[model samples]
Target: MTQVRVESPLATLSPELSAQKLLSRGQAVGGVVVIATVVLLLTLSATVGFGPSVLWYGQFAVAAVTVVYVAVIAFKLAMVFRADGSPVLRFEPDDLHAIPDQDLARYTILVPLYREASVLPYLVERLSALDYPADKVQILLLIEEDDTETRAALASMELATQFEVVLIPDSPPKTKPKACNVGLSRATGEFCVIYDAEDRPDADQLRKAVLAFRLLPDRVVCVQAELHYWNPWTNWLTRCFAAEYATNFSLSLRGLDRHRLAIPLGGTSNHFRTDALRELGGWDQYNVTEDADLGIRIARRGWDVRMMVSVTEEEANSRLGNWVRQRSRWIKGYIQTWLVHSRHPVRVWRELGTKRAVAMHLTLGFSTFTTLINPIFWALFVSYLITGPKYLEPLFPPLSLYAGLATMVLGNVMMCYCLMNGCMERGLHRAVRAMLTVPLYWGLMSVAAYKAVFQLLRPSKRHFWELTEHGLVSHEA
Candidate 1:
């Protein structure tokens, strides 16, 4: 008897096709649920002497807002997809070959560490292996003065002569941005980039960013590199997290650049002009998400931020607790930034001009607020399903319900489309399995958003750096 080999479920499905299928299925399922919920609510409302007018009017308002928001985003994405030439400063490795090598700009890389000893070895090795001239690159391992264990690990490594340790003076509110500000004060490079201790960036990322700077207009002050993950297959949490990163870095950011709006800077691999950064007072020590706050400041000051195609592969938060902590910090920072900027919206809009100011506020300002609102909306939906029209009676009418359902469906389709575009761009189409985790991811984000809001209100509460522990290491023992 002849035996046939069996293919695994994943092996049998074409990654590209699977990604498309997953996106389409999600949109369909979500649309159906939203529509059914609206219809059920409307029917119950009618029986309780509530007309459909309220639902229709409320949905009309929501639909109008959603249409405009999505249209702006879609147009921006199209522009990014159609753009020519590199978005970053590009210096060919061959061009460096002719520069007599001695006149090359000295580059400094700052990796701010706080209780990250486990991943320090890998980070150090990766930085040392970069394609740039080792002699010209100064790798500063910035550590908190009190993080003795991480300092000890760095001392143990027989590192190359190019690497040096910079100990930040101990201070209250020990956050990464504050540590980075201290490092910035000591940096002597013509240009600099920030990396996290857990990052495994591409060796040529620096070279590409330098080239981009040369090609961009004088107004361009910073180059943001695309961040991705190498081990998305390890678990569901990681896979979903990686997908979110890919979508934001690859599509959302590029789209932002297309519209000439402020692109919030990522936490790592962001190349900046030393003089310009210095003029801006470096990173904000008071803000939790200093990078994002800085981006808005740059844009308001008439400087441009561009995105480079170069990809940096880093680890995602594998543990749920770790993910929540990291996310909470980010959301908290967003709330802080939004409040700070909106404090003088009229002045800000006048400085940034109308379009960019509005864009910045909506993208960063409303993001956390929207996520926090999701839980309340979802709760109302479930209540309507269980007790009929009692919960939704105060919100809207029947016709408005249908309109709201349509808007929700359309918005979800757009979101999925944007995500699919990123996956297709990166050739990680198989990673779409992570799409199945969207509901859970949204729920977690809702929880984090609410927590962030609470923390933001209590300004006196000192928040600590919730470190994400890395589980995978490729460095040799």
Candidate 2:
């Protein structure tokens, strides 16, 4: 592929030359278990009048944590509201007319796979139909060395000149990041992006991303385009999934981009500068949510991420078991990322700055923690309303009790309103009614969070990558 706009080229650092990637088998799980055990014992001792003279200290500690959690949730809701008030920078076809075709950049595209042969043909067709110059675009079809079935399908493809097959050696963590790293090692373009086998990116997405890179400051090294499902109306489940994604991409992430805060990149369609990516040693093969971990790493190193106006359509997992497996892996990865960064709190705080460090905790840490523990609080809140106030009243003082009532009213209302507005704003009008069933959707997420925590604690499935089956529906959004 022909290269383009190689500015201030930093020397590429090979995998062998860089420090070994951190895999999350022993570090996070063991450390987390020890911390949890100590906290539990302290709480128990306080309740039994063995640790503190101040009779209410232990219960106060728990209440204080809950107060902080609710406060942050309210703050996040404010960010979304503020984002809606601000203007969004959108690119249209007229804007794309300024750049000449001769000046267009070459971009390397990677599609990592394990056993995705069933969808290879549709993937090839979509990639081939991208609006960018064909000669400047090179797709690296990455397959594991042992995946003979996918390899056979690749051999049969007619667009041999448009793509190249890269065989990755068998590795301990058979993750998407590992395959992406192998593809990155062989990438020959000035800019690069990744797409799953089931994605259909907007035709002018590359152009908008290229323009964003040229127009934005040098510190902005990556651009994330919007991701939404194509078959949003396939079922009730898919509608909720689509609404959740729409709110995150269009509303939540826009705020992060506006304030120059780092956002966890979506798994696909994140365009990056080759030199900057190499400077950071590529993706972490150990972290399940490598995109998010990499985003935080970029911010710590004094770089920024931006959001593009274009969209990439993906297949929504319609099946219950498939959605649960995928969601659990994602939540587990977020936990891994939080633990790895929190290991050196002082260093990370100094590097990421107070504002971004807090944002990172709210984005990664709070999400996993809330999902894992929401059920317990929900039970308490429900009991207070349905059964009687006598059940859990003594635990919380007046201030904490008032705050809990406020959060319950404000949080649930904000979430439902957010989903409805997000769907309507994105022209996904069909999903608004699905908001009525969102509480049930959240319950399922908690179920996945429990599974994620269990898997992270266990020794056997710590590194397992449960693949989500795609190509179930063939609709275009």
Candidate 3:
């Protein structure tokens, strides 16, 4: 039997909504306006003395915003412990038993692979353990046309009856989202999910997601399971990575859910209503962080994305170089998502309402901005500490200097505190000690942020997907 190739033009489906091109016309105009405004302010500042310069007031404004953002971070950290009940959907043993086999919806599992042959056997074993009815599920291994290694590896394996191999035709923009779009076109189920090659999800995750969707409102079209690492104790890098994921998935996202804000979908373990996903045009193939982009689009269309209490354990990148390569791509995609969504702010506000729109910016745009500007603040603080605030007085002022100091010191402490609590919540107690050294992880993130910025500036590298090699670390922890 022969399989026909299928694809979706998610990135370009709507020219105004896609990040296929670096910048839309509206975004370009917006960028120009922002630059011009900054230039005018700087020129006015140069005309005035440093004490009362417009730039000084501008610095004050930024510092004030930073203070507020830090406070929000602190609040989210607090929510990690203080929230009365789980903000995300949680099911008991009886809840799983309540849904009969015949009542379950047809499911599609898409695992897009490129040069990931090493993990094929383990991936298959783990996926086969899923609790869904075997006859009702369709498992698609989306391999690229040119990935001969993975294809040859699959050829030798005796796959289950429900498993099918989908060879995505060789194409430009060889990204995971593009392969996923291909799989989405061929999905034959009421619900669909994407799992990476190295993921080991809880056996009943699919069932939990199905039940969650049934219990939630019709507008809730997606359920995101929490993502943690299978090898959190692999090394310092992996430990830090685990702590970060704990904070992100457990605290930050759940906090957003509690407040009815937009929740960005994780890279894997995101289950979606097939029809709703297709209606949203799948994912942006050109965007490196397609999950984040899709999540925003879901919010913009008045749809809700909820988090399920299930877990998907992935192999964290333990190697430093591999971690940076992966993180840089993520940060780069975040930049792309921010720019793509910020093109039409007015329409977004009208669609998502004022609160959601603001939340989206704080989630996407402002976070990216903060990551990019963090080094600048760090350098200034270092200078302040070494020079005793003498040379930096003009720029910082007395009040602004203290405010900036407070934001820096308190923000890092709150983040570290959140990570520690996140570890405890997830039962990664050993990783709690590593949270103190998480600042080193932040340094790596800044390194990745700069790399992402450089990649965004270069046309050829903008959409390049840096592959993170898996199957190297033992899953002992």
Candidate 4:
């Protein structure tokens, strides 16, 4: 069989989807104008002694935006209650037994590794447990050229014939998606999925994904499995992380699917038709969050990504520094994905339609915007409590004050309730208590969001992939 040399097809196939250019000329100009206008307003207000009046209107604008954000969250919570119409697919035991070993589709599993030697053994064990025929399944472990630690670890292991170690060439953008592209070129399977080093997917996940593909319409080319932490009991951080994942994978993603909106896929456990993935250009090598970008591209091409009922348990970042490092990269990737897609608004609007186009903006653009501005709102609330609302009251008139108050009161209440309910639904009762401290988690997110913005601004650091250290927890719960 001849091997295909696949590169970042975004440059050739669709330059609009590529992250090669961080921002288009139009977007940059618009951004500069907006920044200049804000600066001019502040300067004029300070020099002309009209700062109070400018702040008064600014407060009302913020209050209105907050209402929209809270309303979106409320919509997600409502979707959780209406799960019967969710696009998540589930299969019974009988469904699995009905398929014979000879009839199963050829499946490929790609594991991208970088300085993850510690978890290599665990990963191999998990992959070995996948309930698929050995002859039909192909396992490819993608390792970077300079990653001697992982290479040495794999060399020592007594591996099976189905397992092959694929060395990625030294490249400029040394990213996971780049390595996965090399793996995709060599894949012989009909369907493929990407998994991180510390992932432990359910034994029947691949089979379930195959069944989902067969049962769904031909337009559905990918199946995304739910991801949650296996070590939630490890610490306060892990517990909080697990709670967020519970809501994200189980509720929020389902909401997007129900609405036929573009689903921002999780990093691991996304199963794709091998040919469809290749045609879509594998993944954007320049984008840090390649998975999210691919999900949007899938939707833009008129291909659908369905949610599978299977789960993949991963080790959460147990340390604060590690968590922030990982989060900053993800946030940075979201920024990249948004900028890449927003380059041609009219085309995107036409392709995704009004509803999906708006959903994409809210999911990627507005969510990141909120993370960056959350600190301002938090500081204002603190000031209101400290100095009494005397000076602030003028800024927030009766209507704006009530809306802001409701956002402060009702927003937090709804979010916390969603977190707790997500935990209860997922049988993660221990994590329910950690939901109360989610405000603290938001502070951490703000720190990461700022870090992401800083990195995004630096040309040298824009494509840097922050490696999240795994194998921190000794054992899983």
Task: Name the best candidate (by lDDT).
Answer: 4
lDDT of 2 by residue, 307-332 (tens): 77889989988999999999999998
By lDDT rank, best first, the candidates go 4, 3, 2, 1
Candidate 3: stretches off by over 4 Å: 1-4, 7-12, 40-86, 475-477
Error of 3 at 210 (Å): 1.5
Predicted structure 1: clash tally: 15
Model 4: per-residue Cα lDDT over 205-288, one tens digit each: 989988888888889999999998888888999888988898888888887888888999899999999999988888988899
Error of 4 at 60 (Å): 5.1
Reference-based TM-score, model 3: 0.93
Better of 1 and 4 by TM-score: 4
TM-score for candidate 4, please give it. 0.93
Runs in model 2 lying further than 4 Å from the true structure: 1-58, 85-89, 385-387, 475-477
Off by over 4 Å in 1: 1-100, 398-400, 460-463, 472-477
lDDT of 4 at 68: 69
lDDT of each: 0.70, 0.80, 0.84, 0.85
Report the Cα lDDT for candidate 3.
0.84
lDDT of 4: 0.85
Give one digit per residue, the lDDT tens place, for model 3 in 1-477: 123456544343587777778998877888899999877777766876534577567667666767666755555565565443546799997889788999999999999999988889999998999999999999999999989999889888898888988888788889999999889888999999999999999999999999998888889999999999888887899888888888888877887787777778899999999999988988888899999999989999999999888899998898999999999999899889888888887888998889888777777767766777777777877877788856667666677667767777887887888889888878999999888888778788889999998998898998989998887875444
